[model samples]
Target: MRGSIRFGEFLIFLGALFLFWQYAPWDIFSALDRADLIIAGGIGLLICFLLALVSRWFALDELIHIVALVIGAGLISLSHDVIHTANWSWGDFSFIDCSGGPFSQERDDTYTHALSANAANPNIQVQVLNGRVDVETANRPDYEVRIHTCVRGWDFDHLKEVLDQTYPKPELREDGFSFIQAKPSRGFGMSANVEIILPQSASYKVSIDSSNGRLLLENLSATDLNLSTMNGSITLTHVAAQSVKLHSTNGSLKGQLSAASLAATTTNGGVHLELTPTASGRYDVRTTNGGIELDLATQAIGYAVAADNTNGRIRVNLPQFTTQGQSRNHLSGQTANFAAASIQVSLTVHTTNGSIEIRPQ
Candidate 1:
């Protein structure tokens, strides 16, 4: 009532944040502490004392108001799992251990499972909430998947529980195979890596989404491929796809990529790609905190590009590229139309804090 944030309101918001971050009282800062009731009492009292003076000075709320706010905050903390962590993601910030954690020893075990495949459009869709995803193409006639789960826990049993929850459940149907790992198990650390292998099909598709681990995609041909992760690097090797989309929140994009159309974006990471020469192709790659390197080697290739970098230099080294507009960090132009009718490429690459280089392979 005194200002925008009432005494009780602020306390409520704080309580909610604590719950969201899984920060119990005892584990206020430690990722391993979990004595709920005991710590919740101290936390509630601290909140009460800390906010009382502020409310008195700013809001000048009544004594009853301060008391009520503290009581409510305490209740909230006591009723929750105390999902409060110091690192509450706000604008490109995240915890070091993506899987809110015990931070104990790390272990990983690998196993292979044969999957059901569709005769027509065999697709693989993997969603790992807190681990890496790798996919490769094999000459085998069947579908197979390998899982490697790694994470920290209080003990062997706790670790097993976390790993069990992180394992992906792949379901196969006439359409394709889909697997989604449940959110990191409730009370322990959780992370898992997945590797999928399958024979090529006429219309195979690969879609992988990960919350907090690197992704490696190799030797796969698909009509459409979409790979994304909240915070990890992405690598593509000998990948052949008609259409591809790659994204990351805090990692780089690297490796060889071949596609008719490709779009990649990242934050806090660089984009380095060696694109296989294709007659006709469209590519767009951008990053916020890293450099962009693109190389296309083809004597007969003709390309039109618009490259921009906010805080670094831009260089275009293609002999055939004629610069129409140039600056320290921006370039836009295209090679003469005389390029052989066979090779035509259009590219857009941009970065905020790194240089942009386009060299002929």
Candidate 2:
């Protein structure tokens, strides 16, 4: 969190210092002495520790806090996984698989199955992003697919490259099916990156959460869709549905809407939506560190907007409609003049740390 560039420079400086102490022409230390190696390492660590302590007084403590928070959270998550293993097991040997770095690169035998979208189905769920998940589907689905990155064990850069490759253009297969290498399936590690796609007519409850990848819902007619993310954007575009919900912890939310009833919330993220005049649905948008933009083309029965930003602004634009209602500080009301308009909905918008704009599209 110490600004990546600064951290990189620090690392290079440490490397240069070690090189000078170890191999410089000047006779400083013997290269073959094991005790010298330990002493050198200790000295290097001491330098780093001193620099860390000095940084706390330069308003850089926040950056250190962010880094510590992420590392702590990751360790806690891993611990949770370990504690949930069967029979109080430290780890599950059979189901566990190595994933995400070089060893994950190898491709094994592949298997695939496809079904008709028109066939009878009770539920269909789709998750097309970065986490490992077990997917089950019964509808004809077309998902661009790729195998998880394979980095050799203990090679951080190689492992990072493997993760970067997850976004490659998906490879298609016959019969609306395809397969790719599973991520980090080294011998017996518990990591996966398989995704499922659902048909348009599929009316099943769905939840997709990705930490480092975008979550996009487009041209879908479904009963319900719930999406969440931490470091990626969330988009709901041209979706016509009964119930739609989205949550983004630290990313943007921007998309088009053809639905009448939509609800979304975010933290430290922005929200933007363009609604067509023919679309009249309930809406709820919020953010803690970002702004909100709401454009209502048609008449709406209720309008409630609460925009709060610790370090941001709020801008709302409401055009004159055929009907009018009460208005106050942060709340307003409008007559449902477009009752005959098929979309009966409520409107809720909020934000905390960024700008909120509601303008004409």
Candidate 3:
């Protein structure tokens, strides 16, 4: 009996560890949200304690078990209506709406609105939690934005209702036009894909923030542009801006930019930049664990180039730029005969665990 109990405890401990490792809320804790961290920790502790009790490794009084049961029941009751459907994946567990229940269907809805650019240089801002965003400049007479929303669940009607209540409409503000997701639903599996069409004749300042969505911008002429996402890729083509900033936590960045000043960074994704730099400007590109491929449109005229990688090769294809610290991991030099230039360009690219490739377009 003693041996059997020990074996059972070992199995229980292994199971508990597996579950914990599988479902650990690393992103939440890393975000440093105190309330969410506390709640997650409490729930984890409770699960462990209950598993210990089941394995007979910890002796708990009957009153303690009763109180725990009461608390658990209360939590379940509170979350009953909120647990309709969720698109959550952890390790080998993926929750999908295929149970054919009342809440297992998928629904899609679209909303669109037109805005008139009141100012000479209007400002546009967009915020989305999930899905894709595509922005393009068109030769249209009017500016328009469209939202395509997809919600999946067993309770399709409820999800649709929640989306109708939570999704924000396009509002014309004093400074510009805003099309943002102001409120999010409690526990619905939903994604909103946005498409914005801007007038080609007008220059605008645009800012977009997405938590988990791919962003694509094409043929845009903006005074200032800022795009960022936590876990989604960004692609830009034929974009001209005075100042541009792009960032992603775990996604790639690809841009063909004609910007005066540009900066791009990613934690776990590659960066590909094809830049037509200004006379005097800075282009900074960095990634923690991904490669960088850069193509400069003009010759290395009055340009100071620096590229570095911790655990990968560094290749520079500019002939006039003599490498000073040429090694397997680092390269830095200035273009020859660039000392007397009135304006200069500085390009810096770095990656911790990937390659750096720089060449002329």
User: How well is each residue in 256-290 modelled by candidate 3, as lDDT tens digits?
Assistant: 88888888999888998888875578989999999
Q: How close is candidate 3 to the true structure, as a TM-score?
A: 0.71
What is candidate 3's CA lDDT for residue 265?
93
Candidate 1 lDDT over residue span 55-152, tens digit each: 64543455545555655555554434234222224333333343444454344444344435545556678887666677777776566766655565
lDDT of 1 at 234: 83
Residues 160-200 of candidate 2: C-alpha lDDT, one tens digit per residue? 45545533323343324323233332322222344445444
Query: In model 3, where do residues sit more than 4 Å from their true spots?
Result: 1-118, 153-157, 173-175, 340-343
lDDT of 1 at 204: 76
Summing lDDT over every window of 10 consecutive residues in candidate 2, give the lowest-scoring window: 85-94
Task: Give stretches of model 2 more than 4 Å off.
Answer: 1-122, 126-152, 155-204, 276-282, 299-313, 321-331, 335-344
lDDT of 2 at 249: 60
Q: Per-prediction RMSD in angstroms?
A: 9.1, 14.7, 7.8
Q: In model 1, what is the error at residue 324, expressed in angstroms?
A: 1.1
Q: How many clashes does the backbone of model 3 have?
A: 6
Candidate 3 worst ten-residue window by lDDT = 92-101
